[model samples]
Target: MTARKRLFFMQLAGLILAFLVLEWLAGVFTARASLPYALSLLAYILPTLPLFGIIPLSLNYTNNNPDLPLSAHRMAPVRRYMVRMGVSMFFYVIILMASIVALDRFELSVQIKALLAVLTALPIGGIIWAVSRLIADPDVDEFERMIMTRSVMASAALTFFFAAIWGFLENFAEAPDFPLYLVVVVYFGLFGLVQPFVRRGFR
Candidate 1:
């Protein structure tokens, strides 16, 4: 396979592995802790893993191809991809938010919320993958490829940095007391901030 494809596969595999690890750790914690709290914590933590996919999709859209720049007429495919991605993400956010709100109104079990979150994310992931495949130009040059690589690295670095900061705060403040949703907010915020960097690095 080509380097770019290889990078994409490797990054995807890494993400899957990370999610598995998180799931295992969460499972272990749940086994040891009170069931309700464990389920709630897992529900909040699990959604954040899929949020990482946004970085790759954003980088793909941003660094599509610089040399063979799209004509206004030829840009429709890219524009369509952007629109699809945007709409899918908006719906995903709305679903997640509504789920949280619903939890407030009803005695929605944490396991149910977690399952719904995962199911909702699957379609969003499909949309992102479809849009990326549709929009990415196969003729991307070496420099553009390098830019894409840097963007992915930058996104990973930023994700790690924010996660570390939150870990530190959680440790220092003894803030297991805080709502689980706050951690999800932090993850979403970091993912959003990193997208522009990914876009700018391509230019």
Candidate 2:
């Protein structure tokens, strides 16, 4: 494999391993066990570190791959998209951690809690904006734009389908409640998952 592809896979593997380790440790600890706040936060954040690396590596791998056949014209928009996404995700981590720590360590007023919630949601807006800018960029080639658009549509469709099914199940079948905010994460994941197939079909 090329170095970029290898790096992407290694990062992906690291994320999976970290997740498994974290889950195992969580299982080992009793519900009543009191861990240090910093320790707990570190555990919460560790798996995500691999994701930061994986994002750019995956983008670079895809963009530079001979098999993908993207035009040189499209590369700039893709790079811009990557930068915006990376910045957004970085701030997401920081804001989310701060909000979590604040909520845990201090009893804030309702207004402050509401503000924290808004702050937590803000980075997702940046992600959405990044996608929009890429889609709407004049320099983006039609093929690239079409692929992104189709991937987004597919992601949205799948997300809605899953949410509708899970919502009914939760109401009628005693399934666990799914946090609505996580739908954004699922949508983004599906967006990535659909891209290879879309590109292959176009090829």
Best by lDDT: 2
RMSD of candidate 1 to the truth, in angstroms, is 15.1
Measured by C-alpha RMSD in angstroms, how accurate is candidate 2?
Answer: 3.8
Model 1 lDDT at residue 47? 48
Give the worst 10-residue stretch by lDDT in candidate 1.
Answer: 135-144
Model 1 segments more than 4 A misplaced: 1-69, 72-77, 123-136, 139-145, 172-203
The C-alpha lDDT values of all candidates are 0.59, 0.82
- lDDT, candidate 2, 88-159, per-residue tens: 988898788768866886889999999999999999999999999999999988877899999999899999
State how far residue 51 of model 2 sits from its true place (Å): 3.6
Name model 2 segments beyond 4 Å from true. 1-7, 15-50, 69-72
- lDDT by residue (tens digit), candidate 1, 155-185: 5577667667767888997645455435544
The top-ranked prediction according to TM-score is: 2
